[model samples]
Target: MPFAGTSPHEDYTAAVERVAGQALGVLMDAGGAVVPAGFAVADLHAAQTRDPDADLPGLRVLGSDALAPHVLRGTPVPSDRAEAAARAFAVFPPDAVGASPDTAWIVTWRDWATARTLTRCGLALDVPAPGDGAQVADATSWQTWSVRMAQLSSLALPGLDGPIHAAAREGAEALSRGLVRSMLRRDYRTAARIARWIAWVAADGVAVPLDLAPLLRHVRVFGGGSTRTVLDTRIAQHVTGLEGS
Candidate 1:
C-alpha cells in the first residue's frame, strides 16, 4: 500500500517506490505498453501531483527507465508516456536541485541521462555543459570513490555516456574492488549498484576486470528486494547483454 503524504521524506520515498514498481511491472510483460497503474497517462507530469517537489524525482526516474527498451533495441516509449517525461524534464532542471557535494555528480549524471532519453523521444531540452564538483573530481580513496559510483547506478544506462561515465571507466578497478568488497560483506544493494556501473563500463567496449556474469546473478538473487534494487539489476542485465541469461 502507498503511504499517505505525511512528510517530504515519506512522500519522496513513496514516489520512488511507485515509479520503480510500476516500471518493473511494465518491463515484466512481453506486450505491456500501457501506462503503469498509478496515474493516468495524461496526469503523469508533475504539475498535477500533490507534492510536485517530492513527486518530480519519481517522474524523472520513471521517465529515465521508460527509455531503456528504446535504447536497448528500437522499441519506442509510448507517446503519452513520452509527453509526461518531456514535462518532467521541463520542471526539474538539475542546477536548481540543491545537491550537496556528495550528490552533485549524481544530479549531473541524471541530467545527462534525462537529456539522452528526451532527445530520443524527440522532446529535447537545452542542457548546459556539466560541471564536475570537487567530490567526484578530487576523490583520493577507492572507498569513497566506489560508493559514489554505486550511488550513480541509476544513470548507468546504455548511451548515457559522459565525463562521469568516463571517470567510471577509468576507475574500473576501484569500482570492481567495491563490488567485490560489498559482495563479500553480503551488502547486496551496494554490490548490485556497483555491478551496474561495471556493466555500463563493459558495455562501452572497455574491458571489465571482474567476471561479471556470476556477480550479476548473485546480486540479482540476494539483492532483488526493493523495486529499485531489482530495477538496477534488470538494467545491468541489458547493459551487459545478459538480459536473458
Candidate 2:
C-alpha cells in the first residue's frame, strides 16, 4: 500500500518518506559526492542571481548557497566555485527568515549541514547557529530541527567543544520528546526518521533515552548500498565503541 490510511498525517508521512528514500538513492549513487538531481540546481542558481529584494514569490534564493557545499562534499569541484558557495552561505542574513518561514527553515537547516561539510574538509565557516532558541511548536518544525541535529551529531568532528556540544545534547532531548510525540500520534514514518536520527546521535556518543541498537543492527544487515551504509560507516568510524543502551 502507498500509505496505511487516508489520514492527512499519513499522507504527509508517506510523502516525506518518499523524498527521504529518493535522497538515499541519490546519495548512494553519488558515493557521497553531489546532491540529488531533485534539488534543481538551475532554479537555485536563478534565484541566487536575482536581486535579494526582488518580488519573487516562494523563491528560496539561499537554498543553493546553503546546500551546495554539502552537496559537493568529498567531490572534486573548483576552488573558486567552492569558495563562492561558501561565501554566499556565510553571508546569509538572519532576517531573511522573516520573508518566508518555510524557505528560511530550509536554508538554515542546510546551513547546519554546510558547516559539518566544511569541518569535514578541514575548513571552517562563521555561520550562525541554526534554530537557536527556536520553539518546536509543531511536528513540522520539530522534524526540521531534528534532522539538523542529526546531521550535526553525525559529524562527530574532533575538537568540537563547548556550547555547541551543550546545544547538541539539548537538541537531542528535544528530538527524543518529539519522537515520542510522533509515535503517540501514530506517525510511524516520522517516528522512524526520528529513530534513525536517534541512532545516529547515539552512534556519535551522546546519550539518548531510546535504545535503537537492535534497529541499528538490522539496518547494518539489510540497509546495504544506501544512506544507511553511509550512516553506519560514520558511526563505526567516529563512535569509538559507544552504542545506545
Candidate 3:
C-alpha cells in the first residue's frame, strides 16, 4: 500500500516511488544495465524493497539522493539525502516525472532505483543520481553534466530538438572533453553510445522498435570509454530530412 501521509514531502516521496518503480519495470523488460544480472522484469517487480525503510516521509526531501540506493551500487544515501533529493525535484517537477512516465511506468520504477543509491551516499556528494534528473544540466553533483547535456542535445538529429542541441553547441566551445569533442563534431560513429535505445525511442514513435544490435556493435567498435566522433552523415541526413519534412 502507498504510504498515507499528510506532508507534501510524503506525497512527493510516494509519487517519486511510484514513478521510479514504473520506469524501472519497463527498463527491466528492455534489459538495460540498470538492473542486476539474472533479475527478470517480474522478479524486480516482485522483489521486496529493502533499506531506507520507506517509513520516513522526510526522505522525499533528499530528492534524487533518496532514490539512489535502490538502483545503483557504490552510491550511498546520505543522511541528508532526503533534503537534497527534494530540493532537486522541486527545481524541476516535470522532469521528476520519469521519461514517458504514463506509458513506461515500469521503466520509471527502475529509474527510481537511484533513490536507493542517494539514500546510501548522502546528497552533497552527487547532486542527481542517474535518470533522476531528465536533463544533465539539473545535476548539481557534477559540472561535467553540462558535457553530457551537450552530447544529448546536438548531433543534427531530426525530431531530437530542444536545449540539448544548444547545450552541445555551446558546450563544444567551452567544454572540450574528448567524448564531448566527438559529440560536438557529430562524430557519432566513434562516440561512446550510452542510450541508443533512448535515442531510437526518442527519434522514432515506436517503443524499442529499432534492432539495437548494430548500434551496440558500433558502440563496441567505439570502445566503452573512447572519445566519440559523430560522422554518421547518413543519420545526419535522415535527421535533416526529418526536420525538413
Candidate 4:
C-alpha cells in the first residue's frame, strides 16, 4: 500500500513537523543546558488522541529525519530516542518499492544518523546499509541536480560528512545557481535547503559565491513559517554565524 516506505502527504508533513520541532531545539544550542530529546514517541501522538501502545501509521514513516539533529549534535542521546529512531526505520526501510531519490537520500542519511547516534552512546542499531546506487540520478544539468541535492539538505550537518558533503562542496557553483533560481521563483523551501548547503559548504571554507547575509536576511523576512523550512534556515543560520554561534 502507498508504494511502500511512504506515508500520506498530510501524515508525512506532520511527521516531519514532529521531528523538525526537536531539531529546532537542538539548533537553538542555548548557552549551557544539555538538550536531551524526549522519550521515544513525542507529544504528537498524544495530540492525535490515538492508542499510545499502538504504532500510528504516520509515525512509522518518520525515517531518520527524526534522528538527524541528535546525530549531528554530538551530544548525549537518550537511549529511547535512538531506539525509537531505529524502530521507525525498521518499520519503513530505505529500499522500499518505488522510493524517490529525495526520500531515498533522507533514508540513507537516516541509516547513517541512527548508527552514529547509537554508536556515540556505545550502542548499536541494525540499520541497513544504503545501496551503492542511491541518489546518483544524474548531474548533467546542475540546476535540476541542485533540486535533487536540496532534498538531502538534512545531510548539511557539521558532524555528518561523506561524499554528499563533498558533493555539496564541489558543486558550490551549481548549488548557488539553484539557490538564486529558487529565490527568483519564490520557492522558499527549496531556497532554504540550498541555503543550508551553502552554509555547510562555506563552513568547509568553500567560497560560496552567494552573499549569505542578504540571502539569509530575505529568507528570514519573507519565507513563510513552514516548520520544515524554518528548521532548514535555522540550521543555515547556526552554521553561518548568524545565530547559535
Candidate 5:
C-alpha cells in the first residue's frame, strides 16, 4: 500500500521513495545479509558490483569531513518535483557515508536526486532522447553519478551551500547523454579530452589532487560518467596537472 496523493510533487516523491528503496534492497541483498563486513552501510552499496570503468570522477569532487545527511538532505533543496524526490532519498542518513563496493550504487542515488531537482525546478535536463543505446547508458551513468554526487555533497564547504552537488548533478546529466557515443564510435581521443576537462573541473571544485595517467591507462574510450575508467583517469589527471596546462 502506498500513500495516494493528487499533487504531482507528492506523487513524484512517493515514486522516488519506492524506487530508491527497491534499489537499496536489491543492493543489500546482493551484498550479503548485512552491510559488507568492513564497510559502513552509508558509504558502500552492497548490491551492485563495482565496475572498474565506473570511476569517471574520483573522490576529489567531494569536500572533506562529509556533509552528514541531516545537514544536506533537506537544505539547499531542489525545486524540481522529481529531482526533489530523489535528493530526498539520496541523503537518507544510512546512505550518507560508508564503504560501497559498487560506486554505481552511489551514482544511482545521485541520479535520483537529479531527477528530483529537474522536477522541482520545472526545468528540462537538456539531454537527448533515448536512442542508439544512449538511453540505457544515460540511465546507468546517472545512477552512478548520483551516488558519487551524494558522497561529494556530504562534505562541508564554506558559504557555497550545495553548489558542488549541483555542479555534480549538471555534470552527471551531461555525461549521461553522450558518453557512450564517444566510446562506441571508437573516439578514444575525444573521450580522453572530455575526461581531462571534466575531471579538472570536478577536482578543482572539491580541491582534491588526483593523477590521470594511471586512471586512464588502457582506457580507450567510454561512455557513462561513473563506469568509465578513461574518463575517471582524465579527471584525475587534470586534478594533478593543474599547472601543466
Candidate 6:
C-alpha cells in the first residue's frame, strides 16, 4: 500500500516545484528582461533524490544564489518576486536555517510561517504566549518577536477560547513596533505580510494599536495586478469559509 502521507522526496520535490513556479510567475509578472537561471530546479531534484545531505546545497543554489539576494537587496524585480522568495524560504525545513549565514533569513521566515500555521490549526504546542519575556535586540531577536506577533495573531482568530484575547492584547504593542519598523524601512512586503495578521486580530474583535488601514491600502496599490488578486482571493476564501466565494 502507498504511504498515507507524502514521502520525504515527494515533499522536497513539491517544495522545489512550488518555489520555482512562484519565481517564474514573478519574472513573468515583472516583464523582466533577465530570465531566472534554469539549472536550480534540476539541481534541486537531483540533490533531493540522490543525496539527502545535499539539501542545503540545493537550497543555496536555488534560493540563496538565484532568488534570495535579489529579493533582499530590493533589486528591480517585481514586489511579487520578493514575496514569492519570502514564501519559498518559509517552506524550508527547520534544519535548513543554519546551513549558511547567507540563508539566515530563513529562520525568521520559517518561524513566522509556523506561528501562522499553529494558530490556524488551533494548536498552542510549545508556542510562546504573551509575557514570555522575549526581547528584540538584534536580527535574531527580531525574528523571534515576529514569531510572537504571528502567534498572537493566530490566537486571536475566531472560535478560540481561554486567555487568547488577553494574550493578543498584550502583544499589540510589540506588533505595532514591528509594523512601524517595517514601514520606516520602506519594506512594504514585510509590512503587508504583518498587516494581514493585524487584520486577522481585528477581525477577532481585538483592537490593534497600529493603523494598518493605510499601509495595507498602499500594499494593494503597489502590488502587481495578478498577485494582488490572488492574495485577496485567498484571504476572502479563508475568511468566508468558501472555496472561491
Q: In candidate 6, which residue pairs clash?
A: none
Model 5: which ten-residue window has the lowest total lDDT? 61-70
What lDDT score is found at residue 191 in candidate 2?
A: 49
Q: Estimate each model's TM-score.
A: 0.76, 0.40, 0.25, 0.73, 0.21, 0.38
Query: Which model is ahead, 3 or 5, in terms of TM-score?
Result: 3
Estimate the lDDT of model 1: 0.67
Model 6, C-alpha of 147: deviation from truth (Å): 8.4
The full ranking of all candidates by lDDT, starting with the best, is 1, 4, 2, 6, 3, 5
Give me the overall lDDT of model 6: 0.41
Q: Model 1 over residues 1-245: C-alpha lDDT tens digits?
A: 22344666655555665565546555655343233333333223342354434445676755476566556655666776666666666776666566787677677666667777778878776666567634565777898889887867767887676677878888888999988998888888788788888888888777778888777767666643455666666677777884333
Q: Which stretches of candidate 6 lie over 4 Å from their true place?
A: 1-92, 99-167, 223-245
**Residue-wise lDDT of candidate 4 within 125-221, one digit each (tens)?**
7766655423544567888878877867766766667777777888899999999999999898899988988988888788878888788778767
RMSD (CA, Å), each prediction: 5.3, 10.4, 15.6, 6.3, 18.8, 13.1
Off by over 4 Å in 1: 1-8, 30-56, 61-63, 95-98, 132-137, 242-245
Which of the predicted structures, 2 or 6, would earn the higher TM-score when compared with the native?
2
Clashes of 6: 0
Cα lDDT of all candidates, in order? Answer: 0.67, 0.43, 0.35, 0.64, 0.34, 0.41
Q: Write the per-residue lDDT of candidate 3 for residues 29-124, one digit (tens) a residue.
A: 343213222222232233225423232322332233224223322323334434545454445453454447332432232224333334344443
In candidate 2, what are the lDDT values of residues 75-154, reduced to their tens digit? 44344434544554444354543536654554555455556555555557666666642432333565566654443342
TM-score of model 4 relative to the true fold? 0.73
**Highest lDDT against the true fold, candidate:** 1
lDDT of 2: 0.43
The best candidate by TM-score is: 1
